[model samples]
Target: MSTPATSRARGVERIIDIFRQLHAARRPMTMRELIVATGAPRSSIYELVAIFSEAGWLETSGDGSVFFGREMHYFGADYAAHNDLISRAHQSILSLVRKHDETAQLCTLEGNKYTVMLSESSSRPFNISSDIGVKVPIPWTATGRLLLGHLNVNEIRALIPDEDFVLENGTRIAFDDFLRDVQYADAQGYCCTEGLSHTFRLCMAAPIRDRSGVAVAALCFMTSRDTDPKKRELMLDDLIKSAKALSEPYSRL
Candidate 1:
């Protein structure tokens, strides 16, 4: 027996699901595709789509494909403008890329996964960049270690799915090794890893702490594995300084 309130909540969840599916697809979807993706009844989905379209939350293309409307962009822009961490991180990464000529990113945990909140790409002929908002396994990134610094071993084990330990190359990372890395990152205030997510890439990350000294986000650089050791060390030092600056309240200015 669902009350009206519960029913309305369920409808809201379904609407969110629709948006998530569309974003994950990274493309416009048709009515039939929306039904299959959201698992909502055809009539209900159609009604919701119509209402959203009228409200400028969604739009239909000439081909009848549905996608986010201009209103969604406005909403996202407003969020970015108001979010202090993201706003500051965006500028920081731009500076980092200009100084180091390497891809720089601001990353954070999204549930059990790691996600790039913002990215600035390098202008070098060969560079690596991650898709913003795409979620990846925690074990697949150097930033993942620093992001999990506040969690105990048991909490980390419980948070990460078992299959996430397997690397893209079919190598499985032992839980003990992952725990060791997390502890080291916590102690050192920074972390670096090579060839975890990509065979030819290296990542260096430093934690952006909150007032409580817990890592709320990570600032990172991704460069080729063949980068000079001295350059890598310099980048890591810069990352640590920048992360420390961003953590302080006055740094937001």
Candidate 2:
């Protein structure tokens, strides 16, 4: 049987886990939903919420719902600015966007996920949409899969938890299936995805490497599959070239 001290420690861990879920949500979470999602007792969860709210790590709304606080934004932004990989490659990203007339994104490894640090879209309104500062799971995504190709199979498996690949709205390809796709991308020099985001949207991605040839980010081009294949190939070639150019600055930095 566990002692009272041991039980208290478990409760603390459960509370922290709940906080992480809230952060991962990337949006406000109601008190009831948080409790249901965590399977934690309402009273204990509320107590931790109150404590976190007081500490400014969690912010509660008028409806008593909670979300991550301003402190998180400050810390996340500050970290990105100081993160050398992102700071050194901003100009390259800008150049890619200008050349492609589509969306250009820069993502960096953050724990087991890839966080979008910098993104730009061309003024033309042809499939030019992307999110900045969003953290996406590093699987089942064109850019994510290419990034994972940098690591060996065992290393990739160790970094990602078994359940992390499943997303609410995306198809959950088996781990082995995902690995095969990544291997194929590595051989082809780029990754292409169809209907990953929308039924009509297509994405092509290539890995951005560091000095030692480890992938640090992905340079991607987004367009519609309805577009001409020749146009898509043109965009893919442009993206590959841009990634090569982008890698030079970071590789030297």
Specify the poorest-scoring 10-residue window by lDDT in model 1.
Answer: 244-253
lDDT, model 1, position 129: 76
lDDT of each residue in 27-139, candidate 1, tens digit only: 99999999999999999899999999999999999898999999999999998898888898889999999999999999988999999989989998778978888989999
Clashing pairs in 1: none
Could you give candidate 2's per-residue lDDT for residues 136-229 as a string of tens digits? 6777468777877767889988988777667546566588988888888877778998776556768788878877776767877767777788
TM-score of each: 0.94, 0.72
**Model 2 alpha-carbon drift over 4 Å, by segment:** 1-12, 108-118, 121-139, 150-181, 228-234, 248-253
Please give the TM-score that candidate 2 achieves against the real structure. Answer: 0.72
**Candidate 1 Cα errors over 4 Å, as ranges:** 250-253
Clashes of each: 0, 0
Give the alpha-carbon lDDT of every model: 0.92, 0.76
